[model samples]
Target: MSSSDHPNISGSSQPLLHQKGKEIQEFGTVNQVPLGLSYDARLYACQRLNRVLADTRMLYSLYKKHHWLMRGATFYQLHLLLDKHADEQLALVDVLAERVQALGGVAVGDPRHVAELTSIPRPPDGVEEVPAMLSRLLSAHEAILIDARDAAARVAALGDDGTNDLLVSQVVRTGETQVWFLAEHLVDTPLVRL
Candidate 1:
């Protein structure tokens, strides 16, 4: 019945549960690739992927925030759409992080780290009007698309075909499609009239 009698309690004889390890690699650095690509190419691809990863993470967060805060006559539709977009963005986040690791670079996993790397403007912490929220999402999508297009082109020039393909096929395509969907919601066309 005493505190000292508890088996899991930490004491002079009990040790902590976790072990610490030395840092193996630093962020923003990549090791040489044996997969027929030069060190410079892998390094460049990793750098580009990390940037995309950071922005995708921020976009995903925005989607989730808007999903929960969705309102008005379009609440049901917008809620589902935001959640779907968030899921897609989450998938891209995984792909991007894996691509970074494949290149022997550390992915920016920490949100604080991501915030520092992301170019997407931060939204208001509190909820805004649905139009403002949708606009915010549209802007974030455009920012990612612009960066992805440029990065894809540059990586292709660097002979990083895999990274280039992913940026174009996944990141760029997904962002463009999402932008289209979000933009349509902002059109002033009346649902019941012209």
Candidate 2:
């Protein structure tokens, strides 16, 4: 058919794949985008966020263990630091889980799911040294921060702004803050503490 003879597509000629955000309703009223993200995008964010939560939980336990059991000349400071990190990681886990649920996917619960899904490498059992424990946690947190930023950017590109914003805010605020705290132990250049 000739271009002019072909029927003009109505409504959003923007194509479903590229279209996003709220639009006008049939009655000419604005409506929210109704959590109706593409399946692949939703699943991708779900798995990514779920993995992060699992890894953070593991790191939380590690920090708590170190906080209570660590011994050194700087024991008081290190103990407080570890405890503080545990709380931060715990809050991050909650945030991630909520995002997963918001995407309409079942979060992988249970320890088995975490063991399977977590991308962060596990520290060896019975690591009793302070420096050793801190090193492992710092490494894990770094990886998580990287992944969170990447995943958030990807989701935003796919037009899932809610998940994207959730991850972006966490990545910028939480991960950066944790990095400052962890860096102090290793930097040794009179850096100001968090």
Give the best candidate by lDDT: 1
Off by over 4 Å in 2: 1-33, 189-194
lDDT of 1 by residue, 49-119 (tens): 89999999999999999999998999999999999999999999999999999988899999999999999
Q: Can you give the lDDT of residue 106 in candidate 1?
A: 91
Q: What are the per-model numbers of colliding residue pairs? A: 0, 0
Tens digits of per-residue lDDT, candidate 2, 1-194, equal 54444345454344446556873322111223257777777777777777677777777777787888878777998888888878877887787777777676656567777887777776666655776777777787787778878878888888889878877786557767877887777666654777
Model 1 regions more than 4 Å off: 1-16
Report lDDT (CA) for all predictions: 0.92, 0.72
